[model samples]
Target: MTDISTTSRRNFMKLAATAGGGLVLAFSWTNTLASAVMEVLDDTNLASGKIDFNSYLSISPDDVITIFSPNPELGQNIKTSFPMIVAEELDADWTKVKVVQAPLDTNKFERQVTGGSGAVPHSWERLRKAGATARQMLLEAAAKRWKVSADTLTTENGVVVHKASGRKLTYGELATEASKVPVPTDVKLKDTKDFKLIGKAIRNVDNYEMITGKPLYGLDVYRDGMLYAVIQRPKAFGMKLKSVDAAAAKAIPGVVDVVTFKNNVAVVGTSTWQVNKARKALKIDYEAEAPLESSSDHDRIFKELLSSKEATVRRKDGDVEAAFKKAAKVVTAEYQCPFLSHSPMEPMNFFADVRPDGVELIGPIQTPERARADVAKLLNIAPEKVTLELTRLGGGFGRRLYGDYVLEAAELSSIVKKPIKLVWTREDDMTGGTYRPAVRYRFEAALDAKGNMIGYKLRGAGINSGNPTREDNFPSGAVENLLIDSIEHQSPITTGAWRAPITNFLAFAEQAFLDEVAQAAKKDPVQFRLELLDKAKNAPVGAIKYDIDRMKGVINLAAEKAGWGKKEGVSQGFSVYFSHRSYVAQVADVVMKEGKPAVDRIHAAVDCGIVVNLSGAYQQVRGGVIDGLGHAIYSNLTFKDGAAEQSNFNNYRLIRMKEVPEVDVYFVNNGIDPTGLGEPALPPTGGAVANAIYKATGKRLRNQPFINQPELKTV
Candidate 1:
């Protein structure tokens, strides 16, 4: 009965007739709070005595403040960090603040999508304004009661105090009165110096539920009488289902029904085990609909594309041909990275109940709004007829953004005329498409007599992924006569964003290539980079997309903390990158053990602007760095005749605990508005590790999954 919708501007806060007598406020972030309207649920929906306040928050008679985090939580700690933003402005006691996940209401929330590390930046001002507005209303209520000017009152931990008269009122006591006050359009925001909860380390709000085996993920969703379904999809790319025989599958013990839709077969049964067991008995035939491509074919295509002149130019500076012709030394290398799967631990699962009235969806999805729309479209129903409830995602890394699994479950439920829950086995999830495309980058840099980089040329070729080059990044503005271009080939194999996207592999290749250029010039690697940065700062160059001072800040901090070039017996490599509107610098430490180079630790320095929660921010940086390093060292996806060569973890290796290096995270807090943290820290980690390997064993890692190379071995 509680529904949130947007309307024309009226008031920022509205008094709700709640049975429990509490305040309610609602607003939107679009147009900077100028076009948003506020509403509160009536007393009929407040039978539980808890008011469904604004779209962002609800206050109770017991002094408890519940803040709704509209964005999906994918272990980025947004569920905790976002609420902290509100609590800071509300001046609420941290102990009494509660965080809840807001359901999918496109009208109520802005930018509900969770990927790209953009949640904080998108909601920072809006969330702060929400809390401040509520606090202002409370202060006005207290001032009216005391018959004093509102300016005379100050708030301390959810209490409005009039120090002149020694009179104070708790938020709970003034809640009913506050609800009657007119909404303040403009409220003063707290200065950064007064933030108590914004900088402090706060643990995840759902830690208790997550650790104690409480149901929080998509795979844990269940409903009475809901059937379990396991689908049988095409085993390889470029193939489609020609036919399917469901008789044997239906005959399996505990099997209830067998349904085929969208060229795939789904086995529905009483339990997950029954459906999974029944799926193994399905007889299906698939035929190639497109050219069956293999890893070798991609490799050949990459080489051809790099040498071909048919590439789209993204950026060009000065005359590259003239600069390279006059250079004393030319450095060239080719870097290759394979396709990768976003193998979230929970896999893909969704619960869908389709009926004539409406559709109910409950699961862990990064893009709930997109899923709602896709399901509505698939079922030929109105978008608003579908309601989605988001669960704590085990992990996304861009896999859940497509919502293919959600569509499958909705389709199955509609076909069988029953509520259904769909789950994918680990093998099915791995072999599924929408992978990080395989890419190759060919880099050539021209160095003059003084070993100063004069010209840089980069050509990137990728399968499925468009424009593999970040042309406006670090070196682009620093170097003279820089040229960047790319070529892409269409493939039946699906690919999408994986973590940091194109920058994930490109950063490593560019950084490692820079190190090689530095070595050839006989200059210190760190100094060489600093010199280029100085040139970009002082000299003439094309449009510089990255902030030079911020980039330098992280680089200086990471180098100083890691004790670069000061520790003996430990070889160090340095890498810095600017991506997703953030700058990150990482220093990797490597040592020779038993004639093999082993990564010991990583020192990461980030400048993502003002951090909301230090603890969560630190963990995010560490996790991103570790994820990047692990994938670079041990992860790669290959195909043989259109089928995935590696099905499970046994063949598709990942960095184990023993191979994981210690990560020390540091942040440069400049009080700038927050940008993104989920991806910036990851892009530079691969380059740092690659350079560290080069330092330890004098071998260049031009290929992803350094595991495949004989030069370096960690296990």
Candidate 2:
């Protein structure tokens, strides 16, 4: 995974040079590296010298190695893991390495986005080269000073060694001289087996700061002369502002002003409490802009769309209708999932200082570039006139991808002619925020007389769930005849990407339906899936999008680890899925407890290629499983007249900590490029838990929020 490119090497090195005493090295994802670098030096030294390197790695005279993590960190541990990659290749002392969040610089960093679990996979190679390049430059510096060939020099824990002469120099001792060496494009990357910091378990760099209640998240951002604002939007999706009465709100002692923007009213004041109180005092009127649809309306629409002849054919192989007509048995089922709120711990908040010259924004946003561009567009300014800084996110879950709140802060600042910090109440986020679209899927399978599946067909309907079908996934290539199509109903309800997007609920529905088909065919659930995977591997029907070997690796590992079908009194349910370029298989162990099925443990097998941080990977898998299981069991979002039915945690049930089951995670480290861990583990969890429930009870749960099922009961 090493490459040598002389793209902009000399120019980049020239930009990296400093008048004072620190060595800096950087790498750009773009050709001709030209922007940000990680910097480490004394406060005085940093102030005295030019501090710029296209943002990646810098070594100080004190041997402090600072690695800049270019991606937004939202508890996915990119902050810790990204630095680990660079430090591993740089051969720096892990203890002396400091991780920093790099500001958004399109010129310096590429793909600064944090969504879709793509940050690590995209930055893997470039980060390794950045570190290796720095290490090479330091080695060459020591070689010149020693009058020996650079080939004889080796780096170990921030020190260069010439084992033949038994002479060594710390990276700190050669920091100044290293800066003068030509940036090496012919740098070598370490083999996975030689990694010292990557595979090892490492704690989050901000663990102490987070636990001690330090200021890290966007809500903690503050600036001089800042005004707090709380926006009041229409309660229903298809409603617009009619009239606003801000007389009572303006009479409040702390209320500075109340202004209307884009059909929403913003109450500005000096403190959060003041603005919140003033906002509550105001009386506003709203008018229906469109039909105020409800959950029942969506249900009817889903039915109509599923049966509609007008559908977009995403993929088709062979003749599905012909295969179905000749089949001996056909099994059909429908699965439904409700809309969900992102519900990140920290509510939406952003600080914006909009001036005539430029705008400064600070927040916990997943997409900084979009936010900057959006603000610039809104204010009629150039994109370069906006400076955006990223803070540690409390939790993203894909909600931060949209820059609506960022736009709100910038717009309010411009209106009030003061620095504005806009904060959304939990109610605002839950009822008015973009949500995970409610989707319905109808799956049909045709089996021949030999109990072998011949045809697979799927039709999906959703409220803004774009392309609800994963047309190229698992079962598609395994069947001789396959057809996947989807239709969506346009609605005023705003919907956006959740954790795993369409697969979050699709996996559950598909796997559960497959299990039912296996029962109809009188085959074991695990064995049935294995047979299909074997078909895809040996004689695929169409273009296979998934790696058969990787998928089977996880399935076999999970089954063996959970001792599938071996534990008496425990109903084990198995499920596997491929998403975000990774494969995950989970087996849930359910046992009867007080006349109710309780999942006691789950065994997970993952093939995400080379793991960056073992501890973080485990944590991510465990967290994703818990999130998926909890949401499947109890979480749901319903609507009445285009208004959310649930407001907060009291009504919307989250899995209790005590109710969480034990999770055993195992990874298949096959030495491939690392994929994403943030989302792949979550997609299959619902399926495993649902299948386990079905095994425990003779009833099938086709709907999400299993608590809604009348036959299901829990303590």
Candidate 3:
């Protein structure tokens, strides 16, 4: 299957060259024309003859060069950052570079994903090579023309120059000659210090398209004869459709067809509004499952798991029992976090045109490769028969990872035998979401007389919706000398990734508890953490997943910037966490406003390896602060009778413009490779806010949605 996708992409690249140069010059690190060309050349079985450079680069006689990218852009600023890599090495004008989404062809494109905040870091090395390879090829061609050594020809801004000969040629003029040269396997990439565009503050290429409301998103995609669709999923988790009276739905104006599938009903119409109207008009009967009995039942299951004697210990260090026995002061606390919704601005939607021969799918999807395979499996068609088109996502936040909505659209289109667009209304999207699993964490810390940490034991239990396997790649205990155990409290509700900081959510509770331990010892919070990190770094407890030095770097930077121990009137709190391969620490300053905890300012420091686009990196950190603020102080998803209690914004509140506080971000100046910013900033925010709340009220708020305490007065 993988081989077939690779072949298809190579064929597409060949077709792209012969099809009147309809190539879209998009720069990408993951998937691009250069990557496709390289794949065919590298494959021993696939390369039949000398690899042609013309397959990857298309230069018009008019001096225009177009590069094709296979990866989709979903507002994480890859459109700009990825191109910077290409332009930097190709010596092309940044202003002249244009980006377009690459079509799905497994054979030609590499890494057709836009998640895990890995776009820049993963593509950095490869993209530089692609650009340099192309540049070198063009230089070789120019050197031949000028009758000079290749070393004498230096490429500058896509122009090859021979200083002694005073000869120059644009890459476009030498493109044909370069096409015959074999790709160099050992091309040198530019050093970080020599980079002109990589570290610079460049705006997102799609910023104008987004701000002006251009048709860049999947919702904006239109076809000549496309029909709109709305599905009626089960009202509650684990419910099954017993019957659906679609007679009235079909009677609605512009309603084309009504169909029933596995667990939902679909209403197809001429317009989205008409389909929505028809969907609502239809009456659905669902067989309520046992999980829908009550929300308390689910809570009880989680509690039972937490208390269960049997568990898999993720990490265990040095006779915790003996250490606890010798401790002077023992601290134990339990923290609980509720289920969360991804709630992307753009609700899930997909457009699919399924025919007997093939299927054409278009929409906002995060995992294009996964979507292609899933659609093919559902349609029972060869993977090649399925083509997934990616449009700019309004907001992904991991919701688009699950291509169920895409499969639904394909199924509807196949049944109707026409092109159909399936749109989930706000209600449907909210209720039918894959929620962040609710979790309960239990922590026990044994401290010596001087408030020195002796032993730490942590246990976590949650509805395994987000992660079912106790030993998944992530969330598994990467900490040492710690007993990290997880138990699944199975629930019928769907679950998926909600940014980063999944297990780190427990870190907020753990780090806050550490602060409490410090207080019990009359020690400073920052000092305590640094001491613990020192211990974790050298004599480490169980596993050594976190780079203690990197964590300390961020922590110390944030502490120094926030004046960790000097502030008098204002109270200070701090939290440091490492996740998604990025390390972040935040120091929050809180002051009581109208007798409630009001954050005045938050100082953050991050070490996310390398800074790809400084502006985009800063935006992610800033946005993460806001996102964390909302989750800590306000966000919660409550359920009653297995149905979400909060339907929309009115019931489920989000941090508004007025609620945003001043956030100052400081990036550690280590030019390490870049890590994720999208989620690393999130985990620390919740803990920082919790720590701030403690400073204001002198009370530890272990539970999330901290504002809901009845004893606390509202502003």
Candidate 4:
């Protein structure tokens, strides 16, 4: 039973005894948010009227260092990787360090978020100072005991050593005295050359516990008097609950209540199975005030919107129409993609204990502060009254970013007047739409008399998800007569942020179209991109948003590692993209297996600055690339009359283990601070696979979920 709280004071420290007779240290933070990186806390962060402190870390009498990890773990290895940053600076023996997961406490830790791959890049220097400050205090305590100058004492492997007198003391011997020393306002950090634990491979701290089923997920939370519940949402969009007949459901054993909200209904019982059964037994009716919508309807709307010339122009350089008129050749193409679901292994669930005075919400959430604020607004309660606890997620992938499920559970608890856990069944989760919006893009390019690429134009249309554009997109800031425009057609279905955000599908559309343009220019795809990137790197650009050198480095490295032109019996496809400050290039090799296009191998070159945990970075690249490949090749969602057509794994398929190709990942070496690798590797993988399929079978696929096409479906 471990819990942490925060307080602010001008230089004070307190040590208390835990239940196990171990020591717990609580201290004030002398430095403010201005001292840390500026990007950690957003403007909405409520850091007012408190002297914040480092509310983590405890030193036991036996020299066991317990450090609480600050960020939520979503299978990204932040639980193992973030603590390494601190342990490296503390000079502690890795074998003796113990890690604990910190709950959501904004007062204790600012910006306790795990999204946007910001855990390390935002908190690197701040956490280093935390460990370095504690080490300095321990050394000061040992120096006072020996009556020697503190400057003469050096620390190594959790011990403070005095070289002149040959006197040394373990951290345990100085813990009590160190608590009495004045907290230092400033501490010097160690150089990268001396780091011992950061770059090395370390096993996930929660690995053993997770494999042993030691109750790390929210589903494991239990209370003595809690009830189970299941929310029954509408089957389609623009649906309003007309009525619910719960007489049959309430007659079942263990059925406590059937609660009805403005838009949905929930069945409560003693167990999850009972509530789910009751929910299925209940008869409900809905009122529809709008026309029935389907995937075909969305497609028609997107096409109509694209045909309109009026649009919000995002970028325009030169006279695109004039360039196209004067060109020797002009080419045009269109790409379309369907809505996608995140499909995390864990279905949406939350445990909420709502009282008259406050609320306790526990779940696997990506953004705690946002959840707190949203819950407060819905319940008309104060923000501070809402307490959230973070749990190890089965998988996030941006599915947990919107905590609508959390709010639903809290509302159920409040209405039922009991602690309740709400779970969404697979069918309910599938039809309830928070999908990635479907989009369509129209592209046109022009080449000069010598077949030199000169101009570009793009028009994007989607259902409320307006458009996707990045400052460093291929040919961006490289072409003179370039123009990009987008229009939106609103839809009734719900949509939220997916992995890689808008850039996920945008990269596929842009990169695939560039390959076709290169073919028309009569040049190799890789060399054609290299020539444009050279232009973007040298002069003749508006504003460069990406490092051309880093981008080119990964592209060349991937081509070399993959042996692009040397591999025989396998057709290869190449693609590169930059996102979230990381550069990545991928090569995919394909072969016809049993008269179907099969991906044999994929090689990747990534430059995400410094690698925090070598093994974890490797895993991220592999997982992201495979996720993108699997989704682009076969994963898609369709709707009929505003309801999803697929329900579970039987209909909505994922990449199987047998289908995954051999993936090789490599990262460039550098001393720069580590950037995120969770997303950049995904954007290019889809395009690489698409281009490879084109080589294997001389057919151009302009739509996603390539397996749905007639010829490819035979496999």
What range of 10 consecutive residues in model 1 has the weakest lDDT sum?
1-10
- Tell me the tens digit of each residue's lDDT in model 1 across 55-107: 65666677878766778898988889877888889998788887767778777
Stretches off by above 4 angstroms in model 3 are 1-65, 465-481
Off by over 4 Å in 1: 1-18, 31-54, 713-715
| Model 2 RMSD vs true structure | 5.1
What value does the lDDT take at residue 306 in candidate 1? 88
TM-score of each: 0.95, 0.95, 0.91, 0.92
Clashing pairs in 2: 35-54, 36-53, 36-54, 36-55, 37-53, 37-54, 37-55, 37-56, 38-56
* Model 3: per-residue Cα lDDT at residue 393: 84
Segments in model 2 whose C-alpha atoms lie over 4 Å from true places = 1-20, 31-53, 713-715
Q: Candidates 1 and 4: which is better by lDDT? A: 1
Rate residue 181 of model 1 by lDDT.
Answer: 87
Per-residue CA lDDT of model 4 for 1-715, tens digit only, reads: 2221222221111222222333234332223332321111111222232334545555655787776665778888878876677678778877777776666666767777777876777776666766777787788888899998899999888888999988888877777677667666777888787778877878888888888877777777776788999988888887778989999999999999999986888999999888888888889998885666898898789778889977888888878889999999998998888888888888888888899989988878888788888888988999899988778888878888888999899889989999888888777777784888888999999999776778999888877675655534667788888888888877778887788887888888888898899889998889889998898777565767778889899999999999987878898999999887788999999999888889999999999988888889989999999999988888989989878998887898789999999999989887778887888889998888888888888777778888887646644
Cα error, residue 533 of model 1, in Å, equals 1.6
